[model samples]
Target: MTLQKKVIWITGASSGIGEALAYEFNKKGAHLILSARRIEELERVKENCSDSEESVKILPLDLAETHGMNDKVLEALAYFGHVDMLINNGGISQRSYAVDTQMSTVRRVMEVNFFGTVALTKALLPTFIEQKSGHVVVISSVMGKFGTKFRSTYAASKHALHGYFDSLRQEVYDHNIDVTLVCPGYIKTDVTINALTGSGEKYNKMSKGHKNAMPPDEFAKKLIPKLAARKEEIYLGGAELMGVYLKRFVPKLFNKILKRVSVT
Candidate 1:
């Protein structure tokens, strides 16, 4: 469907895939509410977009601050009176082995990635139900589809999103609300650099796979069409997407491959 005049709220719009989505959606004449913890960066993203002064609204938000979710939703709705779509893209990653990871570290990741995202979505659900029309997009990872080394908490967080949104999709179907889970494989972003370590420190290193992954712009370009289609779920990536199918149809072989995979 055409997104002209569509009002979309995108979290994590300060960088990476979220930044790219902001530009692409703006090009389609969609009004945007750009959110992230960094207000300056959100302003930078807004300024860089076409017709952004009127088309984009910068709203600073920290995903971990779940208690303030209702206020944020109110502010977002105040920006445009209504929201046609909400993109939950702000999340953290893990780069350390689970055994070495502290419980606090795991809790932090879950707080930001899973609980925070769901909180925002829940906060906005009432509006959609009232309107009887809306779309929700969650930018999950291929890691959500299957487990791998050194990213246990991260994977669990993503997996929880898949389960939650899947059930939400079904429940909201009658309300005409679409829930889409986008499983992205390696995209060349700073995810690895900012990933959490065992002790909750930034990993500060790029991985071999990310070194040769798709660019954020291309990924966003490919994503809009899928979003317009209102797909229940879509996996975006190169060969890494094959793992989703392998895990589904060949569990034994998938497990063997996972042990040897270069997840770093």
Candidate 2:
């Protein structure tokens, strides 16, 4: 879909990839609804956009607030008459070993990353159906494609996005509702630092790997166009993008490599 004048809602727009996406789309002439828990951060991003007041709206939301999602989405949707694309990008990350992780941590991760995304998508489905044309872009992870150390819960949450969206794609293919699942490797983001440890607490420290990853703006620039074309699935990263192939064609080698890689 052409982004020009399109109305897009991007969750997790307070920073990182989502924030970069908001700017990129703004530059491409898309009207945006930026959301996250930090209203000030959202405002900062909005200010940076050209025609900030006219082109963008900020709606602060906590995706993990399960009970208020319906109301939150209603309020967010009030900004645009119709949402052309809903970017399900708001989510938390896990930072503990799976075996050591508490059930609460797993549930919280699933709640924010999986259920929250699915709920928001469901809430907007009727609007898309009415329009008969819409796009759902999910920002998953390269880890979604494979299991990694200290990230079993996180991997599971992202992997669930693939399963849910892939199924929804087939179900809605006839309705002109396009779904794009983005599996990105590390991009410069606070996702890792904010990732949850075993006891359901934030790690609050950036991982060395994340600090050295690709810049979010560059990653967003590379990704947004593919999304515009309604690609089914796209992977963005460096050598880690190759893991998709390795996991499928060389499980033994992939396992070996994964063993050597550091997740935290």
Candidate 3:
């Protein structure tokens, strides 16, 4: 379905893919509810949109705080009286080995990346059910489908999203609710820089692969059309896309390849 005039709520709107998507959806004439922890940054993103004042609304949200999500959802719904789409894009990444990573760090990752998204989706479900039509788009990762070095906890969080959303899709099928899981491989963004190290400190450095990855705007441009087509899942990236296929079709080889790749 077209995004024209649709009230689309996007998390992580301060930067990266979420920020780029705001511009793309704005170009499609969609009314936007831009959300992130940084209200000032969210406003900056909104101001950059085509018709900032009329089409965009900033809703600062901290996804890690699950207790407040229901209230956030209610406030979001009040924006346009209904939300046509909800983009589950708010999450954190990891850049540490499982052996060295602390349990608290792992829990923080899961809390923000998995439970937070689930909580918000649950809060919005009643509205979508009443409306009888809504799209739930999740920005998962290639790691969700397979294990990789230095991303054990982060990968686990994403994998959890796949399992939960896959089940939700089946349960909501008859309700006219659609779930699209977008597994993005490496894309040029601050994800790596902000990734948590084993000690839970920011990695603070971009990886070589991310430096050469697809630009977020370019990824967003390609994503919108697929989303409009209502695809259940789509992978967007460069050579990393091969890993998703290899893991499914040639597990042994994929395992070997993962071991040799200089993931960082």
Across residues 57-90, which tens digit of lDDT does each residue of candidate 3 receive? 9899998899998899889988888999999999
**How many clashes show up per model?**
0, 0, 0
lDDT of 2 by residue, 1-264 (tens): 678889999999999999999999999999999999999999999999999888899988888876777777688668777789999999999888778899999999999999989988988888788889989999999888898888999999998999999999999988899999999987889998898999988899998877889999999899988997789999888877898999999999999988888767
Question: Considering summed lDDT, which 10 consecutive residues are worst modelled in model 2?
Answer: 64-73
Q: Whole-model Cα lDDT per candidate?
A: 0.94, 0.89, 0.94
Which portions of model 3 miss their true places by more than 4 Å? none
Quote model 1's TM-score.
0.99
Total clashes for model 1: 0
Please give each candidate's TM-score: 0.99, 0.96, 0.99
Who wins the lDDT comparison? 1
* Candidate order, lDDT descending: 1, 3, 2
* Weakest 10 consecutive residues of candidate 3 by summed lDDT: 46-55
**In model 1, which residue pairs have backbone atoms overlapping below 3 Å?**
none
